[model samples]
Target: MLLPVVALLAASCKKMFDVKPEQVVDQTQMYRNVNDADAAILGLYGKLMNLAKQHVVLNELRADLMDVTDNANDALKQVTLNNVASNNTYADPRAYYQVILNCNDVIKNFQIMVANKKFTRDEFNQRYGDVVALRSWVYLQAGIQYGTVPYVTSALETIDDVKDESKFPRLSLDKLIDTLIKVTDSIPYKDVYVTGSSLVTTIDGYNTGKFFINKKCLLGDLYLWRSAFTKSDIDARLAAGYYKQVMETGGNGDYDTYRIKWSEVTTNNDIAVGYWNDGRVNQYSENMLVDDNDYGWRSIFARGQDALYNTEWIWMLYFNASFSPENPFIDLFSNRGGSYLVKPSQAAIDGWDAQVQSDNNFPYDARKRLTYKTLDGQPVIMKYLYNYVDETTYLPTSLLNKPGKWFLYRAAQLHLHYAEAANRDGRHKIAYALVNNGLSYNFDNSPGAGTKRDVTNTQQTFDPETAYQFDARYGDNPTFRAPWHRNVGIRGRAHLKALPVNGADSTTLIENMIVDESGLELAYEGSRWADLLRIAIRRNEPAFVADKVYNKLVKDGNGSAAATRARLLAKDWFLPFKWE
Candidate 1:
């Protein structure tokens, strides 16, 4: 039987906040100091971590890149088939609202913490901004998963308060996005926690920085969604502006830090290998029996969380094996010592295989090897092989004992998002360069005055606007070594051949490349559906998303492919909210 929303809310509150009457205390006790404030914020992240599997599954299974295996239960199959039932365990909206409710509690009480002189202005700003951004993020995800959700800002006191439909009416996705954009734009502390802040410290042997949502990145995402919804150049530029701020702010105002460098490659006979300069070897090969250090592009996932990974990942939630809730992905994707519930779709596998690497010796993307591989004749997701002793062996006797990661944002995604915004804003070539090659490569190759297009200009036409320019000019002049100069295009870094840019439809073509590259670079990372949805909404073309999902289902020999496409074309794009 389906549970009512009130039952869900009540269960969440009872689990999260229930206490005996003697132990129940006032807000003043909880907000006594910064330590208490920090505890509250950390508690929110703990709750968020509980929802990680739902976030990844809803965003992925409902889209095209991932598919359920024969072992997958009814809930998984239903979501993949685009026929999600109200009682599907994965379809629960309560977890999302539970996080939102706590955020409301924090938001409401933090003010009292400040008014009582328990927190300094700086402390209040930093902590309050985080909770606000996080709450908006959860709400945005909820709105995306469900077509409409009750947008409640303040924490409701009783189950009746939550059950009152008139007081907390559901808001449509469009209105929800507008509300989020407005709320996020006003966040006072848009930057990360300043150095030495308690929130920046390590917890349980992991740096806490990756746990907090980035305000600017969230703003960029909000504006990007708004731009898609409105199809407005102004909103697109606003999104680009916020994204640029994130890229520039990453290395303490030095953009060069995050830009992938051409020098960061393994050289063979004076030729660049397009792999990370890290010394780790790529042990996962067709001939290799055991997967060793799958470095290069895969290091972003394989390597232990360290300084290097932080450079790329803006936000990631880590689940410790010792923690309360175990890693859900262990059973969902792992084929070793776990229920292999899902595997990479054939369409996604073929998409990567179709690409030829920049080295020209390989016809497939090396990343595909790291993304997923055949183990014992079964396609297994290799990315989440966190506790595996080798390619074919898993170390943990109990799969639930293994720790897993939930990826949220990263540098490559940042670049692609900015490119999306800039492209819609009419900076087509700039957008293409970001996907295929770095800004400097295009800037350096721009046609000289009166030079023939074939001779001096092998590159696509460059936009001359200062805003579109990345200023990659570099040499003996130390001043020229700016951040944009170090940018090797996203595909360039991946060692893939640059998809040529031309024709009157260049903007659309580049946008499509961005989406495709996102699939190749970020598949199974909880973004495929949102990326498709955004583009489909922007162009008002249901076929854009429908065809992708259709192809996936078709390859699986599902009879529902045509029906799913028809439903999507009719704009029946959201999961049903039938809680009865």
Candidate 2:
């Protein structure tokens, strides 16, 4: 319906993450009707796609989870080693700002369309609700990754909009939060899902609820970032309140709104058999070992193609090959055949292995196997892989007609976000269940008839292929369940380094555990850098940050340990935007 333009040809970060004058559309014409407004909304998501993979490198690779293999290009290596420069090409200011400009276009024009009676009141709020949340989500990403950035809200309709330095100066952290809070407060569908199974026409084709931001999800994360950056208990409480609203809405007591579809493991007729061989259903095949899907972990990525409406993804970015062109992620991360510039760090592989609780004849944390694969003595990161799944399974990737589905906000992150903020705010009971108990919990401490466990009943068994812990059939109990008491869920399934109900840890240690759980769940998904940076910047704890991220990279010989440490200690933590 509409064609999205590239970054404005003007200076990057020089003028409000400027876009050239040609990039701006006629606000009057674009807001003519609901259909016209829908086209403009599509443009916003197109720009978001441009930022999706860039965010991964900006956040994930800069942290410890990734490293440049010998085959990686110089620019990628520089970012990996923290040897980035001011004019380096990948350090593009337009990456974040481009998304902002698209958002600004929609935010600026919504009221015009609404006043014209082009859309009913509810439809206008529905549209306005999305525009508001999308803008905040962009700013949240900006605040976490880039220290201070030029903030703009009104449409950049002229060269004057592009060149006016006095109009939009880089905002301080506090100012960014103020602007964000004001915007988030205005959305009508805060914790609520607005799309009701109807498809809207956009540049990306017809789509549903998965692509739109859930207002409370954005607000909760925004507050969490503010709390982490400012170290304010007040901010932390605000974040928890929003997250509590999210829990109350769709996924109450169960991550049903955002969980993996593990039922397909056994339910599918062509499902890989013998995934959990425990001598029960001998579905093993020709290979000595079971296939990756048969093992349970690979299914997450395969299933991610349809995860949009699921509980695991609060919101995600979808790409349509026919409507647009190519999904950058598929080109960048896919292994079927592409220029593979990066891979998982050896440290990440080792760290994941070390974190596993028990062998049980396979890997402990399903994420490790699910996240990466070893090739040529190196770990090829496979978190976004779908080609293999398309070839063998009935996953929705085939149905999506596109391969690039980037998860922006997710439930596990929220679980830990709530836990991190709650722990910081001295809400131990709330933080404890978010991780240890999981959404699968039944209200009672006792096992749910079959799969539950305890210290004395540590050897109890649930479905080995099951990703979720609680069962609705047993009556969805919104509390801790069997394996949780015996050190499951956040604990390694087999490794079981339990967060004791009566553990003798101080507040500091419990908070650390909560943050670490975020790592375990959200790893390799473009969040690690901010997770480390937020605490380091707030507490002035470079030493601790170095231990969590830098130490792992250096010890694994990713680059010179001295250079890594020196770069970290000198000046600031995040890369600076080089203004002309």
Candidate 3:
């Protein structure tokens, strides 16, 4: 069910340039028309969408598990740690290049048009601006994911032209970032045409300014990239400056102010840049969360009665209602009983019980609430849940059918990022405050937030200890503990996870705290892998230690001390290049 927009565009380009066409237009003749330039720009956007699809899969694959334990699944294991080199066939370097190719074509073709004076001054600026911005975006994606990648600035029309690819050697990380910044500067933020209808004006105009790339999105992305790169290489002050810019540009604001009601995403905002199917309102949510009998099309990992909601997903890619069958999340959570596969892990169950106990103020700040459910006994945050399907029949109902919007960037994430950056810069107090602000948004305050209910002043109140004990009773049996039971504390009482007050300045402690926060605040949002890698590099943690604990039921599996130790020493923890 992957989209075929790229294939179609490539085919169209070949047809346009083919010698055998019924009527051929030479390159000289093509740039003479304004429509030709417009078509070229539109093709760039089409390519952007195609690239986005590939990213969605890559994001999920990075943290995806085989059976709930920390051990790599078939897909991840093949490309990540503890897997055979022969299993590396799934990594698709070409998918990224496809985007780069489109960008190269736009840049090259647009330059030709500009040189020929084929467009008016305004037209030339607008069209050229978009292509440049898009090119920068494509390169940024490649740089972030693959680190040093081949930089192809020119488009190739034939396979033979790409044979001497060595000529386009990998660019250093610093050089790539500089190049991206230069490209970004050429484009005007406010003037570019948006893809959808305008929100302010009622008229159905061409410039909607809602979903298209704009100044705010670009700035936010630049800030993120700069923050990442500077965290390791550049001056701390430079990173701080970038983060300050992000906060000032409306990147850090209230979710309710921008978020669409009932949906898990916002339409258009200063920080938000992209769109995705919000499973919360979409049929996928209803089918996956409510209708357990229809487990055939849910996500493969979190399916059936074992299906769980991911509260940390800040941005989820959109899936067409018609394409529900192809969405793995939909099939994984659908309730066809045990038809879907995957046993829960012991580590996960233990983690769940610990979270429930900590929610009621047991040992200390409970990190589980950030990543899992509360300990008391309330339903898990249903940010991705919907009630549109009949529970017994597992059929879709009109009441629950709607498309969910994808939020590219969110204020909460900005806060967390700011905290990390601040900590890196030795601003411990600022980082702690920012982290608290970010956590404030989703804190719970009810008795049954995580565990069992006890009689209170007048009504039944959830006793956190009771809830923890309940989960402990079923820790060995993954089948008994429902996903909702995992977060009973979320609905009960408000509590924030404790930040490292002692080691705020210590690089090791700061790195550990940041990693822990990311796990809590960004888990299952396709961020775990990157977070792990960044921390490992930043803290100099053992590369492949057996200390890692995945949330599956296997006794002494990958998360066991031995396996974690082994992983810490292994070089395969980082993803390998498809060929090397």
- Top TM-score: which candidate number? 1
Model with the higher TM-score, candidate 2 or 3: 2
lDDT (tens digit, per residue) of candidate 1 on 399-449: 446766778888888889999999999888678778886765665554222
Name the runs in model 2 displaced over 4 angstroms: 1-29, 158-164, 191-207, 251-255, 259-275, 278-297, 304-309, 334-336, 358-364, 388-402, 437-488, 491-502
In the range 441-486, model 2's lDDT, one tens digit per residue, is 3234454445433223222223331211223222223333322232
For each candidate, what TM-score against the reference?
0.87, 0.78, 0.58
CA-only RMSD, every prediction? 5.9, 7.8, 13.8
The better-scoring model by lDDT among 1 and 3 is: 1
Query: What lDDT score goes with residue 107 in model 1?
Result: 85
Residue 300 deviation, candidate 2, in Å? 2.5
lDDT winner: 1
User: What residue runs in model 3 are displaced by over 4 Å at the alpha carbon?
Assistant: 1-73, 76-89, 116-147, 158-163, 172-240, 250-317, 321-407, 438-508, 542-570, 573-580
Shift in Å, residue 184, candidate 1: 1.3
State how far residue 333 of model 2 sits from its true place (Å): 3.1
